[model samples]
Target: EPEVTQTPSHQVTQMGQEVILRCVPISNHLYFYWYRQILGQKVEFLVSFYNNEISEKSEIFDDQFSVERPDGSNFTLKIRSTKLEDSAMYFCASSGGLVVFQETQYFGPGTRLLVL
Candidate 1:
C-alpha cells in the first residue's frame, strides 16, 4: 500500500495563528482523513473526505478547521485559528475504498504542531 505523507514534520505557532498542513495521500485512495493525538490522548478523528466533499467530521473539527483537495494528489488541513489545546500530532490517512464497510487506512508520519 502506498503511504500517506505530510509536510513540515514539526511546526510551532502562537495561539490564534493559522496553520496549513499539507498531505499527499495514497495515489489510488478514495477516502481521506485527518486525525489528531494530543500529548497524552488517544487518536481522535477530525474529518473524513470522499468524492471531493466531507463525508463526516467530529465535533473537534469546528469552524476553525477546514480540509481541501487542491489537486489530484494533494489534500490539506488548515487550522484557521490555533489554540493551546490544539497542540498535537496531526496525521493524514488514506483508505483504498469503503465498499466493505471497513477499509485499512495508512497514516503518515504526522506533523507535530506546538502552540505556545
Candidate 2:
C-alpha cells in the first residue's frame, strides 16, 4: 500500500533561518494537509490544500509559513523564518476520498523540527 513519507525525520535549525520540510504523499491521493504537535499537545491542523489552492487554514498558519506541491508527488512546507516556538512534530497527510471512514488522512511518522 502507498504511504506518506517525510525526509530528515529530525531537523535542527537556528532561529530566524528558513527551513523546508519535504513530504511525498500517497500516490493517487487528492487532498493534502499539514499538522503539528508540540511535545505534549494535541495535533493542531495547520493547512489543507486541494486543486493547488488552500482549502482551509488555521490561525497557526501565519505569514511565516507556506506550502507547495512542487511536483506531482512531492509536497513541501516552508518556514520563512524559524522561531523556537515553531519546534514540533510536523506531520504530512493525504487522502483519496472525502468520507472519514473510507478515506482517512494517512500520516507520515513525522519530522521533528527543533529551533535554538
Candidate 3:
C-alpha cells in the first residue's frame, strides 16, 4: 500500500515571498505532476515532469514557477514570488503507467497555501 505524501500540510506567506511545496511518491512511479485548486475554483494543471525534465506545463506555470526532483526521491514546486491569486491547494501526483493510455495518477494530500 504505497502512497504519495506532502509536507507542511499548510503554509502562510506574504505576497511577493517565495514558497516551496514538497512531495514524495511511491518509489517505483515514473511520471510526476503538479496541480492547484484556487479557493472556489476548479483544479488546474500546472506542470508535469519525467526523466529528469519537464514533460508538460500549463500557462499558469510561468516565469515565477519551477519544479524539481532534488534527490530522485522527492519532488518540489517552487513559486518565486507569491501573489494573492496564488493562494490555493497544491497537489502532487505520480503515475507508473504510460500516459498514452491515460494512466491513473496517485495524488498526495494537498498542501494548502494562504497568501496575505
Give lDDT per model, in order: 0.95, 0.94, 0.94
Model 2, residue pairs in steric clash: none
- Residue 88, candidate 1: C-alpha displacement in angstroms: 0.3
* Regions of candidate 1 where Cα sits further than 4 Å from its true position: 98-100
Clashes of 1: 0
Off by over 4 Å in 2: 98-102
Candidate 2 global TM-score = 0.95
Per-residue lDDT, model 3, residue 113, is 98
Residue pairs with backbone atoms closer than 3 Å in model 1 (clashes): none
All-Cα superposition RMSD per candidate = 1.1, 1.4, 1.0
Candidate 3 regions with alpha-carbon error over 4 angstroms: none
The superposed Cα distance between candidate 1 and the true structure at residue 33, in angstroms, equals 0.1
Residue 26 displacement (Å), model 2: 0.4
Candidate 1 per-residue lDDT, tens place, 20-59, comes to 9999999999999999999889999999999999999999
lDDT of 3 by residue, 3-114 (tens): 9999889999999999999999778899999999998999999999999999999999999999999997999999999999999999999999665348889999999999
